[model samples]
Every structure is written in structure tokens, then in C-alpha cells.
Target: MEPVTTHSNHDEPAAASPIWPWVVIETLTSPDETTVVLDGASPRAFSRLNRTSVARASATAARMLGPLVAECASMSKPRDKYFPLRDDQLRRMMTIPVLGPSGHVHAVAVWVGGVEEPLPRTPIIGAIEWSVKGLAVANPAAQYLFRAPQGDLLTGHTIPEMLAAFDIWPDRPGFLSLFNLENLDVAADQWSGTATLHYDNPTDTHELFIAARAVGTGPNRVVRAVVTDITGTQNPGHADLTLVAVRAMPITPGHAVALADLKTGFIHEWLTSSPSSPLAAWRHHNPEFDDNSKLDVVQTCFALATGVRDTATHEVRVRFDPADDWIPLLAKWTLIGGGDRPQALIDVTPLAPISAPMVTGCRMCQDMANRNNAPHQ
Candidate 1:
């Protein structure tokens, strides 16, 4: 990608537009977290060899070169001036060298001033050449694990810790390094803007998808990692988007599901508590409403012959009969008076079946039969 140029004037406010164009060179560190910034003049002026060019160079030198001299005087700064090209200076950035499939140096990425950049080949030819020549005899152990073309290391957790959580480990020592991280399946390079990394552990499959241009950077060149869990199922009424409802339904015959419709405020309170119930789940899922408002409804389902109670206050009690196969499912809907809206929203459906007698003998039935000539109640 062509380096972006920003123009700024020295005489005007630092924020003002520039009269002369400048290219900001960023070097990224190995972890891709830290960065170093360098300011360069126009390509035309850098190509010229004159006193004015040298003076302009000196003024800019104080910003970057002073630190370099204090740190290491023997270091050779890049002669290109358009971009830094010194060997020792480049190595100090501590970027991992990326190799192509053919075992050739593909790119050198450095972390500088919190930005990651792949240096231009023309300026860093010497460093690339040197790294290639040494590759033939590089450490085999190091080569095996740190060979990933791209991707950052999983931070804040060690490989051992991850393995311990699953009670397993790779058979080889080199399998745990950052270089061995699987290449993100998504094409992030083509993205024109910031990228996001997504981790999915669906069915315990450790995989990642790189979504390009999913996030944007700030003025400081800080890249944010955006992660989404693709494996988890989202419940329509639950917060934390659970895959399975904490409440269970019986699979036996003659059993039915029952739901409760509670006020919205109480539902919100439940969801905020630890081990939130279905009502809490509903509130967690819908956060747009104020908790102080009356609850439109709270719904819950019960299996016939099961006893359930509110774990929080123990004030609500519900019981189901074994003979009841159909239970009501509850839903709450807001009603605005004198409006075209519905005054209430209620949906009751049979969730299961009942095995009890299908018919009953009633006095009304006998009276109807005798209505022609006999007495009726």
C-alpha cells in the first residue's frame, strides 16, 4: 500500500493544514502493540542533494535522530531519507521477519509508536537480504512454531493455562508459540480499513475468523481487537445470550409448557441479579426500556406435575398437574389507552399433551336430553 501523506504548515497552528507534505513512517514491535513514528519530507526534496535539504533534514533530525544517537551512535540511519533504512536500527524495532511459502523473505514488519507497518522493500533490501541468507541455518525449533504468516498472539493467557483448562496439551514443544497460531480464515489484507479478530469455540473447536475493516483506528494508531463468539446460540428472551434456557421442559407424554407474564420492572431487576431467571433473561435481552416502568409482562413455562417457585422472594408459587398436557405460554405487550394499538397482547398455546380422560359427563348434558318433556335445572 502506498504510504499516506499529510500536509501541515510549521507557521500555523500544529492542527492547521500543512503547506508542505510529510510522510509518517511507523514501525511496529513484535507484539504489534508498540510503535515508533518518523517524519519525512516530500520525495522530491529527499531525492535532491543540497544544503537546504540538509538543513531541513537537521530540523527534523532532532525529533527522531537525537534519541537514536543517545541510544546507539554506531547505528546507521537509512540513507533514503524518504524512509529509514539502517540495519541495526531496523532490528531494534524487533518485528518478526515474515517469509513466503518459498522460504524467501516476504516482508519485515516493525512496531513503532504503536503501529504495525511492513517496510518498503526498496529501502530495507539489505536487511531482507541478510535475513534470507541466514534462514537456511536458522533454528529448526524456532522455525516450526513461529511460522505463521500473520496474526497476533493470544494475550493475557499462556498456552499452558489454555491447555490446562481443557486438560490436554500438544505432543510437541514448538506447537505453542505465537508463530503457530492458525491463519485467520478471513481475508483481512484486502480490507481498506481497520480489521477485527473473532474467536469461535463452537463445539469446542478452537478456530478464529479475521474480519477485515471491522474496526477503525484512532489518531494514535492504536488497533483494537474486536472479538465475537460465533458458536453460542442467542436466546430471544435471555441476556448473556444463552444457548440453553436454565429452565427445562419435560419430554414425557401428557406434559405441557407454561409461561408467566410479569411486569417489565420486576423482570429487569431479576436479570441484574446473579443466576438470573427467565424474567431476568428477558430484561437483559431488552435493555432499551427504563426499569422503573411497569412490566408489560413476564412469561414462564411449567411442566405438568412439576412444582416451581420464585427463588428470589418465594412470594410467587406455581404448580402443575400430571394430567394437564397443555400449559399456557405467557407474553407481555405494552398497551397505550385510546390508541390504535392493542389493549393487550396474550398468546396461549398447548406446548405438550395430556393423557387424562378426553370427555366428562355433566348435568347440563342430561338436562338438554330431557328438555323436550322432563324437568331441567
Candidate 2:
């Protein structure tokens, strides 16, 4: 049998501390069962148990090894993983494996601690291979890794359970599986897109955004990605109204002709259209534009910034007060590609109430709208 070795000497009284304690035990593995060959510890804990067999010391630990050893043996490196004994009060155990020449676990090093306390990281028996910053062995909600198409491993982490609570999972397991390597398609340099995913229940689905960066080429085929559950934040309680479309005109210094800008609110409001204040489309400096106009002071300030544009068309024309600080706007609407923000120039002609021909045509259009929406008998 190999002699047991540890960083701390068990013989010295000064060498022992409560926070950093050692309990080394030798394991005798047979084809049938595993038992304790020796119970090694310091003056406090294991020293008193030198006479107890593995079953006498803790039968619970002896049984827990079945699952723990199986899990530790599956890992690629020599490291200890924490497994909480939920059935036992606040009790946690670790499976630290000492590797042999064949790169297989030859013996198990165990650590018993409370919920807050972690296992000692220093090597007590075998190889010093586990990362100092390695994540706790608790079962995380999700684990992900990013690699180059050529298989260079990049950044990865155990997606914390907190995110799992919000339901962040990949849609259709696009490239997260890692074994098939087809899942690698979810990432690429400078990629931004949305996909749905599942969690605890495979049938229960949620959404996530995949953003990737190509990084570089060749041996350094670096790619980066951020998979996030946007279901929580998709509606920002407001929208960032960039000047999507504009009809800039001259002749009036402070007096404007048209207004185009962004508004903030839930995304549903951005995608939907209604006749009322349409899109909460607050336009600045207009009181009589529409009865649906924000009849309150809070919106008066909002319009001063987002432009008094109707949410439906995202365009407003100062047809009411032409002589005053007049601004008029027109927008082209498409039901299919509303999400596409395009930078194209289009011509516009303002409405005039006095033009009999234009007035008649407008009245006809209004009648057609009323007829389409009128309920049938």
C-alpha cells in the first residue's frame, strides 16, 4: 500500500485548525465492495476514529460513495466535486479522487462540511489538478461551452440556477449538445439572433438571444457568445425611439415641419396598432392634434422629445395649425416586415383641408375604412 501524504502534518498540535482540518482515509476496493483500510485524522476528529471501520464511522457516507464515485470518475480531470446530502441536515460530502498512472481514480479523498464551508483546495493525497476557482459541484441548471468550429475550447460556465428559474434554454438544442458539433452553429463572430429553449421540463419552452463574435482565424478561431433569457427584459417599459424616418424641411427655424423619433414602452405596444393615441405615439407641442393625444402633462414632456407622431403611422402632420410652428410627417406601413428598420427616402405631400378634390378623396377613404370595420348582420 502507498503511504498517505498531506500538506498538513497530523502530529503537531499547532498544525491543526478548525477551519482547515484533514481527515484522510485509505480505501480497500474489491470486486464486491469498498471498505476503509485506515481512518486517518488529526487530534480532533479522525484521531478518535482510528478504530472504527468505514461502516462504523458513517454508513451514510459509505452508501453515498456509489453515486459520488460514479460522477467523479466521469470527469476529465482530477478534482473534487461537492454533493449535498439533502436527506441529512445541512450535511455535504465531496468526492476527491487520487489519480493513478493510468489516469484513473485509484482512491477517494472525502471532505465533510456544512453548507457554507467548502472543501480544502490544497492537495491532501493525490494530484493538484483541480482549479482553485472551480465552480461548486452543485447541479447547475445548465452547462455550456463555446468552441471554434475546429474544436478549440473557449469560455464556458455552469449557467446558474437563478437564470434557470427564469427559464433560459436553447430552442431545439441548436448547437448546445456539443457531442454532434452541429450545435456549434449557434455561435459565430458578430451574431445576434433570438431562439427559444427549454429547462427542467423539456416541453416547457422559453426564449433566448444568441450573440456571437467571429473573433479571429486559423489556430485562434476565437468566437464569443452570450445566451440570455430575454423573456424577463424584452419589454423595457419604454422603447428607444431612434429617428427611424424623417421628412426634414427648411424655412422655419424653431418651427418644424415633420417629427420622427422613438418611444419607450413594452415591445407589444411597438408591434401592435390601435386607433387611440396609436402606439402611445407622443408628439411634442400639439394639444388639438387628436382627442387620443396624451390629454395629460406627463405626455406633454414625452412628446417634446419623441415627437407627436401617431403610433400607427409613426408620422404626424401639423394640418391643424399650419400658421404656427408647423411640422408634418408621413410613414409607409408594411404588416409583414415591421421589425426591419430601413434607411430609405420616400416623397410626401401634405394634406390641405381647403383642396376640394383632396378633401373628397379623403372622405371616400374614411367611408371605406368605416365600412371595412362595420360589423355584418
Candidate 3:
């Protein structure tokens, strides 16, 4: 039996601060069941005994070895000074010291549960050794090392096989080359002409064109390819002229031709019976006039040409009717890609008779009166 060390000394006033010591205690009532205790001590241990007693009240509530040792070490106490016990008792206690430097016991503790057994050692040889040995003694002729074909590792398929699977066969001669080595080295070269195919729906028209510079090596090698729909002229009645197409021509000077120019071209051919001449006198009468007013005649002419009208107040209004008399004239000469032409002479008609308004100040009235009153002038 060894002397049990205690934390207190009367000369030191017992350092009344609480001290938590980790110790495993074998109870006499249950010899097999070990209990761990967090013994709280102070210079005067009795002062806080009741509060500390609660931690030791039950089996489950007992402090375990690891945490108790940690708590003791955190307080900077020596294990032997706090938990001195015999070697045989310590062995049975299965206590492991949470050691600090050179037997300076930081904490004293035993496992409340059974001690964890040490794991057995295992021997392992790494893959690098086997790889190095295989590389050193590999025979080129026997093993076909460098000569073996390179391929997709997962699918184990060579380049030619992959191309064949996709129905791609090399049309150019000497497009694919292969090399083989016995021990560890192999190489292959491949070249091919590239082309792409496309199918368009709805229009059912096919247009193919050269897309890129020549590919592969030789006269018959494919360079590039493209396909498109060529159905623009196929359907007789289907013009495919949406409002978007009609509006695409810009009103800018350099970029777009004026409507006046369109009237001079072949557009007048479709609007009139005589392709070479303009409209006749009877055809030029105004609906409002018994004898066409000069204003009405001028208005009808301009309205026929540009799909716009000049009001009595001199403001211009756009005429949106597709069935207007001059629309046919404009449409006929102004074929889709025709360039610009003059407006006045494009579809000129003989002036009709005007009566009622004799105003000379208004341009519309003057123009209409001039046409009616001055034929030679």
C-alpha cells in the first residue's frame, strides 16, 4: 500500500479554489463496476460539498477518464499530487496519465469504461515500385510496348473503329496510318476530309454550297459543306412577302429608292392596259366632281402613286389600302430587286376637266386647274 497524496496543506491555507481531480474508484458494493469521480476540493472542501455532490450522485453522471484528465490538466495540476495510488490498483484501474513533459503529471485518470485496445500493424507495398520494375525490364518485341495501338480506355475502341461506328469512312487515300512497338512505344497518324449535311422542312427545297477550303490531301477531298431551302420561286401564288419584307427597304437616300422612282419603272405596266403609256382621261375622274375639280384630279393622281393624300388643310395622310388604283402600277414596275426611277413621268395620265373651285392660291387646286385649263401651256 502506498501513501495517498492529497491536494491540501494547512500552511498554504488549502487554496480554497475548487480543484477537479480525475480518479477511477472501485466500489466495494460492486467490485466489477468501476465508477469515475470528479472530486472537487478547495482549501475548505466542505463549503461547496453539496453542489459538487450532485455530479457524483448517479452511475451515468460520473465523469469519464478522458474529460476528467482534460479538466485536471487545464488546471495545471500534477497527477501524482492529486491522484496517488498503488501500482497494482492503478493496473486494475486502467488509468492512463494525460502526460506533459518528463513525468510531470498534468492529469491522473483511468477509463470509467474498458480501455481501448491497440490496433495491429499492417504492411503495405505501394504501386510505384511495381510500375518502376515493369518499366525497367519490359521487352519491346515480345510485349509490343510502344507499338500497341492507342485507343479509348473505357470503350477499348480505336479511332478508326469509332469513326466507323458513326458511319464516317475516309475518302482520301493515305488518310489513316498506324505504328506498333513491342515493349512500350507506339504511334498512329490520321487525316480526313470534313463535310456536314442538313435537311430543311416545310419548303421542301434543297440547296447545297461549298462551305470551307478543301480538306484532306488531293483533288477529290471534301472541304466544307452547307445546305439551305431554295423554295422561293417554286410556288406560283405564294409570294412569301410578309409585311416585314415590304418594310425592310430603308427610306434613307443612299440605302433606299423612293416610291416616285418605283412608279417610273415597269410598275406602271401592270396598273394600265397599255404597258408603254399612262392612264386615260375618263379613268382619271374624281368621285366627288361631276366635272372633276383640279384639286380632285391632282389629289387622285398623287393618291394613286404614293398611297397618300393631301388634305384640304395641306396635311398629308397615308393611304393604306392594298386595292388602290395606283398600287397595281407601283407593284408591277417595282419588281422585288429593281432599282430606283423617276416619279412624275412613270405613270402620267391626261388631265381631266375641272369645274367648281377656281382658287389659284392652293397648290392642289392650282395643279388640278392647270391640268384642266392649260393643256398646251
Candidate 4:
């Protein structure tokens, strides 16, 4: 790969700079938990860019380039996923790489964020880019989009060399990326935007958000876009904003399947740590909650369980009683397992629509339900 652009700082790269500095080794000495990858900040933050730096590279440098080793030692194996560094201060970091023909790292990129923030799969493309790898989409129905003046879409399943296939749309029907594009051209190398699209009905769609950054100054610059989902709100124009109390009884033998094995662990964890929990910290900045908040959470889960529906076909539903008018959308999703293991996906769909409020009492009823549901994080 040709250099994207020459840099003034010969070794260390600026945070937003397209320049990537990585150690391309025939192999790492020991690619294990003790792999001594990048540690905390140091006065000598960077090593020399000499040809033999691979033999003398730092753990941080080795980790920044997460390529399969060319030669594994007796105890080592090929990496199935990214590495986890040992740094108490840093919550998480991921090293994504572009591999060459020999399956060695040609370029490297890194992302660091807090534990609460989900890891981003945003593409990192540079002018000196490699072939675009097909995205590992969590949901098969997810719409992959490419930005252009007329709003272009990249066809799914097939990996395109570079991003040449960014605008092949309508060729695949039913499979679509719904977005209301306000900006046609993204001027910055790094930028993010949200698009609101209607699904099922014009009034029922949710927002699709993307944050992307380009890595190269040249034409081959790879563009990485990270996508995430946010729960949608009711459109005040189409539907009347009214309260509804969904039937709070558990699913019968006829309509729904049993709740996913009540996470005995969550219960166990809760039981063992009741008195020890920081009640003040939990209620801080919120006067609405008191010492009984934890107990209220247990009650709320029981009530929400009424809305939890699992079909005979292994479909799942977690419904809010007074939700906005949204058509039942059945889709398959692969949720994260304990770690890399992929959990079995459920065919999720709503058992029934909230047609109307079963019973609408005074403000007292609404307040109670809100408090009951409040303990749910």
C-alpha cells in the first residue's frame, strides 16, 4: 500500500491523522494473555520505524496490529478475535487491520472507548486501502448504505474491491436501507449523521444513526461507518398520545411460550447484595427514588413479564404497555453471548398490537405504573 500522506511527526500519528504506524512482523513472540501489548502512556510513546522494529516492537504496537501471526509458537494459535490489553485505566480497545495476500497486516486502526459504549465496527478506509471486506452484520435485514448526492446503497453479502459498489440500490428488493437524507456530501474525513426512515407504515419507522471516518488522503481511502440503533418515539401528528394498560397477566398456555429461563444469575446476584448496595449512590441526583427502589425493581420485572411474550416458534417480544403505534416487525437478531460465542437468535415479533387502553383511570394509575417500570435499567 502506498503511503496515504507524508507526516511531519515521523513516528507517532496524530489522533485524527490518516497515517497508521504498525509493526509488520513475520510473527509475535508470544500471542497470549501475557502478550504484553500496548500499556499505559509513556514518555517514549513510539518506537523507531526501522525495518526491524517488528523484532523490537512494543506490546501496544503489536496489539495495534491484530493480524494472524505468520508463525505461531508451540503454545500459540491463530487469533479468532481482537486482543484485550491489561490496563486498569483504559476500559476497552480494538485493533482492526487490513490483511494482504499472505494474511499479514498491511494497515492497522484502533478504537478506544469506555466499557459502557458498545464496540464500533465502523470501517476505516485510507487512500492506500485494501479490498473492502464484507461487513459482519448482526442482523441480516440491516440495510447497508453508502453516501452520495442521490443516496446510494451498497449491495450486501458481496465484498467489493474498494467501495466501488456504494450505489447499487433497488437491485435487492424488500432488503432496503431507509433514510431521509438531509446532507448529500460528507465534507469532513470524520463525521456522523442520523437518518429518520419509516418502516411498515410512514408513521412507524425509527432512526438509523451512523458515525464514519475516512482513513486515506488518496482515492483508496477506506471509509468506516459504525451503525447503532436507538428506540423510536411516537409521532404526535399521526396517533393520539394516550395511555394504555396492557393485560398484566402472565401468558396462558395458548398465546405465549414461557419466559426465557428467568436469569437465575441476576436474581442470585440481587439476593446476595441487597444490604451491601450503595442506596445513596443509586438514589443520588434523583429525589423520586428512595430506599425501596431495589425492591420496586423486583416488582416491576414481574409486571413487565406480563408483556414478555415468547411464541411456540421461539419468537420473543418485550413490549411497553403504552407504546406508539408501531406495526409488529418480526426480525432475527444474534445477540452477544458471554464473549465471542454467538447466542442463538430468536425470531422476534409482537404477539399483539396495543389496540386501545384496557382501563384508563386517573393520574394515580399512570404514576404507579411509571414507578413500577422505573426500576428497569
Candidate 5:
């Protein structure tokens, strides 16, 4: 916690200057939220450095640090405020509220010009810096959780790599929602949720509760994430229901491909909120679309085939690259005549390769299910 850089007020315009006076007002609120105890301020001797009132300089801290506290509390977000000095030099101030895990406002950090560095790290907490490129930094606790070396910095490590031993439960999109910044507006409104990852090996799964806040501004912004492994605390009711669907739809090789007449050799449906279909191919290929989209494609193709034929069957080989491994699917479409609006029934199943391990369901989730179903003494 170094003091914010100060500038000379000698006819120099502070508006264009990058450095100015700043203070971090720390407080501890009572349980009922009626009283606020000013714990202390970072960058000691704040009042003396700024030449403010002596009464403002309490033994613990300089109370409030001028009007920045009141103004910041009123707005309830980080914003810049411009102040015109006697010499007509405009000073810009930005207030950022620091919130605890429970969404309690612990402190208000006021910067005179710009933020020079990221927020102070809580060494004991599992924290990481993430961007679209991948993980940028992993603190001590985060390193331990992700199995990275204690002193090693996380550079270019993707989330999949960090959790390589786990299968992201309910697919990647559900897990990624925890890190989404769509709801991030203020410090307290940071994106946070629990994501379950079933360990691939013969071990228990993990439920990671993550709180991610967008730090910095514009293109330079990165996510500041705090992670907690809540595996032991999560309710069993939170079990991924997608696993049950996967178990129900077993994969089998197709007998023949008859509906090749349909364009793309796959079904296409415009469904968006459909439950994820049991598609084993996506986990390995990392397709651009989720299981739901893949299922929609399968359904849409069936619809097209039913329009022409009474019964049709299609075998779809999905692969982005010819050299890459592909997923085969068998879709059967049956047109039931005498219906009000061309009613049809469709069945979709993965085509398993000869002498290959079952690929119909998530291996990790299926393994856990088997163990849970085993009879106890």
C-alpha cells in the first residue's frame, strides 16, 4: 500500500496530470449497520500529507478523507469527480468501493487521478487474474487449488488446463456463467456462482464457488476471481441433471445412412432453451456450439427428412477438420400421417466406434453414478 503519487500545485494544470492526492478509507460496520468504526487508512499520515483538519486525523485514521466518502457512498459505484481548485487547476478523483465476500463494503478507495496497480491481494484467499487469453496470475491459494507450483505465475494457462482432471458438469457454458461479466456493475455486483466439475479419475468431484470482478477499464480489463472449493458443503440436490439424460440415451452404431438427401446430413432445429442432448462428441472436439445446438441440428435435419419420406434414417459425421476426430450420430425420423400439422417423431443417438470405450455419457459423471449406486454392506 504505497501512497498515491503527489504533484506540485505550482501553476501546473492537474487536470492533465496523472498523479494526484488519494486515500483509502477503511471501516468496520456494526452488525446492525447502524455504526461505522473507522479502522484505519492505508498510506499512513493521510491528513498530514494533504494538510487537512487536525480533528480529521483520528488515532486510527483520517475520518472520511474529505467529501469523496459521502459522494462515493451516494452514487454506489466507481466514478470520476472533477474539482476546480482556487488556481483553476481541475483535479479528478475516482472512488472504488472494496467489498467483502458477503457483499459488505469494507473500504472506499479514492484515487486522485488513475489507478496505478491492481487491488491489494488477500494472500490467504484463492485469487486469480483471468482474461479471454487465459489465466494471468494465480495466488498462493489459487495455485494450491489448481495444482500449480507455489511460486509459479499462471501465464497462458486455460481454464481447461487448470482443471484438466475434471469434466465441467452440465457442459462448459453452465460453468463459464460463473465468470461472466454481464451482471458486473459494482464491486458488490460481481459475477459469482458455484460450478461443479466431476473429476475424471476415480475420485470425488468438486464444486467451485467463484466470485469474479472486472478490474481495470476498456480493453485492458481483466477478471479478478476468488475461488473456493465447496465440494463438501454443496447440497446433493444440486447434482447435474444432464448426467441423467446422458445415461438414458445410450450410443449405438448406425445400421445405415438413408437420409443423406437432407442438406448438411444433419437435422436443424431453431430451439434455444432445449435441455442439452447427450452428445459425447463435443467434449473432445470443443465445438463452437453447445450440446443443445448440436441436438437442434439433429432435430432440424429430422424435420426436413420427414417432410418428404414416411420414414428416414441418417448417419451424421460431425468434424470441424478432416484430420480431427469426428463424432457420428444416427437420427431416425418418422412421419405420422393423419396428423393435424405433419406431426413427426425423431430419435437421435451417438454412433459408437468399433472396440472403443463408451462415449455416450460423461465418463466422470457416470463413474460417480456407478459408485453411488453400488450397494453398501
Candidate 6:
């Protein structure tokens, strides 16, 4: 039997800090049900017993491995198991089923403690291996972040699939581009950025700081990512507006218009003084523009940003004064790029009142009026 080698010297006092080693072993089980240790720097003291028997070396492994192996077989993916040792020590074991080119598990890789230390859930960390087959390996933390389905793992699923399933759409322009795996290479060592994600359930939002680094080489290289929820650290109780559309001033200023500019434009274009104060006003000024309408706009904007749609047109009813009848306006929205900032452009044109009859000869005007009258579902 090979001697178990570790940095901790046996001559050192047992009272000295103990260095725990995690070992990997072959999957073959003996008739006695003992596992053969392939390699690891195990404690020399523990080696006094059967050094090659992983079950004899660590009581935690002896207990956890049997059940974990069964889970991997049934689920077709590895699951993590954690157990505690004496002296407030925690041990985490992650089993990886190594699949051969034929899509069969040829061997198993058991990664034990010493890597994932200081077991705190906050600022979660995970490891992933990317390849042509999508995520070849995703740690349990990564599975939780992507909201993997119960009894199923994140392995074999693409990033976009997980993002859509969890309703974790990127909140800013060009944010989704970062996940384009084709752009990543061995030369690309690290990535760090802040991403805001909008959740559909109960309409919640989270701001996350993500940092990742490449730890291995080739197409199947391992990348470790750490995500920290920084929502509370930012301005409290306010959603950051991701400006999708910006209207430029018509004159020489040529700068994007602000909210005040919108107010001024309303007065100049509609020939009426603003009725409601700027603070009390909302966009479109239509009673039908409720939470659902807002959500539709958000989804449409995301779709446009992600290349799902090219252009979307709608008819909006607006009124400067509450007492006055609403004015029908045509709004056309399209994605605009090739500038420092990503933005969309909207063209709004005033139309005849809905009560008025459309021109008999004009097909476009008839269709526009018909759409304007159609009640939104």
C-alpha cells in the first residue's frame, strides 16, 4: 500500500491545529464494501489504520458516499452532501459523474473539503464547466441561483434557458451579451460586473455583483463565479429606471430630452398648459396604463433589446388637463445602437380624436383608428 503523505508532521503536538485532507478514490467497491483511495494528502494519524480504505480513513465519507452515489445514479447528475466532524468542523462532499464520449459515466470525481471554506450562504459561490454540451458541471450553489427544477440539476442546460426559466432578465442594455460563451477564451481570465435582474413573481428586483475567473484551460475549462446581492447597499426603496428610449431635442442642442423637456414639449405641441404638476404626472396619462400595461412595455423592451423583436407600434391616449378629452397619439418604438450608450427611439405623432371618422381613401389612417378603438385585453 502507498504511504499516506500530508504536510502535517506526526511529531507535532496533537493539540496543534489539525489539517484535514480530502481524498478521491476509484468507484470500484470491494466485496467487503471498502473504497480504494486513488490520491489525496490525508492525515498521517488516520493512515495508521487501513490507509487505502477511504471508509476507514474518514467516518463522514463512510456514511455519506453510499447514499450520494445512489442519488447520482437516479438523477443522472451529482448532488452535494455535507456533514459535520468533531470540533465544530464541517465537511462538504461533491460527487461528479465523469461522462465518457459515449455519454456514459466512466468514473466519478469526488471533491471533498478544504476548497469551499467558511460555509456561509451569503455571497454564494459556485463552479461551472462550459462546453459544447452546455453546462457540463454546475455546483449546487449555481443550481440554486438558476432555480433548477426540483429533482433535476442545472447540468446539460444552456445559460439562456436557465435565465428565461427563472425570469431573470437582464435589466440593462448589452448586459445579456456578457453571457455569450463564444466570446470567452482561455485568454479571458476574469470578469466582474454589476447586473440588475427583474423577477416576475410579486415584481421584485435584485442587484447583484458578479465576479468570475477561469481556473482551467481548453473548451471545457472550469470557471468559478461568486455572486453577491448588493440590493440593500444601493439607494433604498427605489427601482433604478433602465432608460430604454430617449427622444432627442429637435433643434441644434441635439441632446436627449429630459422629463422637463417632455413637459415643455407637451405645452408647445398640444397648445395647452400642463395641468398636473410634473411630480404628479405619469407617462401616457391613460387610465388603462396600469401595472399590466407597464409590464407589457417592460417585456417588449427586453424582447427588443435581446433581438426578439425589431419594432413595436402602439396608440397612446394622452391629456394635459384632467377635464379635457384625451388626445390620440401614435407611438413607434425601435432599438437604436452605434453610440456610447444603448437606447431606443420613439416617434410620437398626434392623431385625430377617436370619435372623428377616418379619411375614406386612406387605408393607413383607417387601420390606425381601428387599432386605437380596440380595447386592450
* Per-model lDDT: 0.21, 0.30, 0.23, 0.27, 0.41, 0.40
Q: List runs of model 3 lying over 4 Å from the truth.
A: 1-345, 348-364, 367-377
lDDT per residue as tens, model 2, 1-377: 11212223122221122232333332212112222322333211112232333323344544554545445555623333333232323334555544532243433555555446755663233211111111112111112211111221211211221122222222212222111112112222232344444544667554444432232343333332323334343422221222221211232221212221112110111211222212112121122343333232224324332334323334444332344333344433212122212111222233322221112223333344555457999
Indicate the residue-level lDDT of 120 in model 3.
21
| lDDT (tens digit, per residue) of candidate 6 on 174-229 | 23222233322113454545555554464576555444444344455544343334
Candidate 4 wrong stretches, greater than 4 Å: 1-141, 144-153, 156-187, 233-377
Rank the models by TM-score, top first. Answer: 5, 6, 2, 4, 1, 3
TM-score of each: 0.18, 0.21, 0.11, 0.21, 0.32, 0.29
**Considering lDDT, which of the candidate structures 4 and 5 is the better prediction for this target?**
5
Best by lDDT: 5
lDDT by residue for model 4 (154-219), tens: 222222111222212111111111110112112234333443444455555554333333344333
Clashes of 3: 20
TM for candidate 1 is 0.18
Residues 97-189 of candidate 3 have per-residue lDDT tens digits of 332212222223332211122322211100000011011111111112111223312112122222222111222112222111112122122
Question: Distance from true position, residue 127, model 3, in Å?
Answer: 89
Clashes of 6: 0
- Candidate 1 per-residue lDDT over residues 1-377, each given as its tens digit: 11222223221121222122222222112222212121232111111111222224323322332233222212222211222222112111222333323243322322221123334332221111111001112222222222212232222222221222221122211111111111211212111111112223424332111111111222222111111122222211212111013123222222212222121111111111222112211211112222222122222211110123221111121112233232233232222111111112112222333112211232322333334335556
Local error of candidate 1 at residue 178 (angstroms): 33
- The candidate maximizing TM-score is 5
- Angstrom error of the Cα, residue 361, model 5: value is 25
Distance (Å) between predicted and true CA of 243, model 2? 93
Candidate 5: deviation at residue 40, Å?
A: 20
Candidate 5: residue pairs that collide = 267-297, 267-301, 268-300, 268-301
Q: Return whichever of 1 and 3 wins on lDDT.
A: 3
